[model samples]
Target: MRKIPRWLARAPIPVFRLGIGGLLTKRLVMIEHRGRTSGLIREVVLETIKIDGDDVYVISGYGWSSQWLRNVKADPRVRMWSGWGRGVGALATILPRAEGLAVLDDYRTRHPGTVRALATGLEIEGFTVDGPLPEDITERMPLVRIRPRR
Candidate 1:
């Protein structure tokens, strides 16, 4: 797939926020987080890997350097809107390497095509559709676990 420009990457966010994307809520979610420096509310659309009980798992395709990840790391409090429901106060936690790998493995098993396509699009070296996930890919793309606060 061709690379999307920064503006194009976020083009669908408006539709998602308006709840039109709720049809894809099973796979997509809108994350609302505060900016680390500016402290302004920012939103991003992300693909959901899995939802186990109260925890929602997602991957950072851009890895640790992602702005949203940085903001979540600084403040775990966040809001999430998805097909399942809306979470006003969610806690975002960066999962450990082992847990992240497990999540990735499950995702790959469930959505082999998407995994392969993402790997190819991200230029993750050594990632094959049927092969094991490359170590470098894990390091570059971390999984985050989100739990709605009760």
Candidate 2:
């Protein structure tokens, strides 16, 4: 039962890379942060929702333990890329946890179905699913928001 859905969910990466990859090219905002331990540039892609006044926000729904998150914590200075294309250097500001929650709320509203599917897929992938849950679910999850520093 779950295998079918899991396969179906996992099946889209290649297609996305093919069909949506071009659009996603610059869509994936890559943040380059220095490693806390090694002091090297570590880049990770976070999908951006561009906002007014040159602001872009990415909800780290997977939470704060990611390497990128750790790097940012060590050093806020970062270079961003919208896919392979280069982006201007911007400071990485960790949006306050409370504000981050709001951003996640908006994300859920804007992408209800995707949110649900991602929650399930991530759960199957053995990632923590404690931040936010689909309305039908029986748990809560934490979300983080990232905004380009001015």
Top TM-score hit: 1
lDDT tens readout by residue for model 2, 1-150: 132353543443443333343455544555667899999866565666434355567645445546677677678787655533345577776665566556666666776666668658565332222455344221133332344555
- Highest-lDDT candidate: 1
The lDDT of each candidate is 0.80, 0.54
1-150: candidate 1 lDDT, tens digit per residue: 234487866876777666677676568777899999999998987889899986889888877768999899898899987774344579999888888878888888888898788778877665565767776666778788989889
Which ranges of candidate 1 are over 4 A from the true structure?
A: 1-3, 84-87
What lDDT score is found at residue 142 in candidate 1? Answer: 79
CA RMSD (A), model 2? 7.1
Among all windows of 10 consecutive residues in model 2, the one with the lowest summed lDDT is 136-145
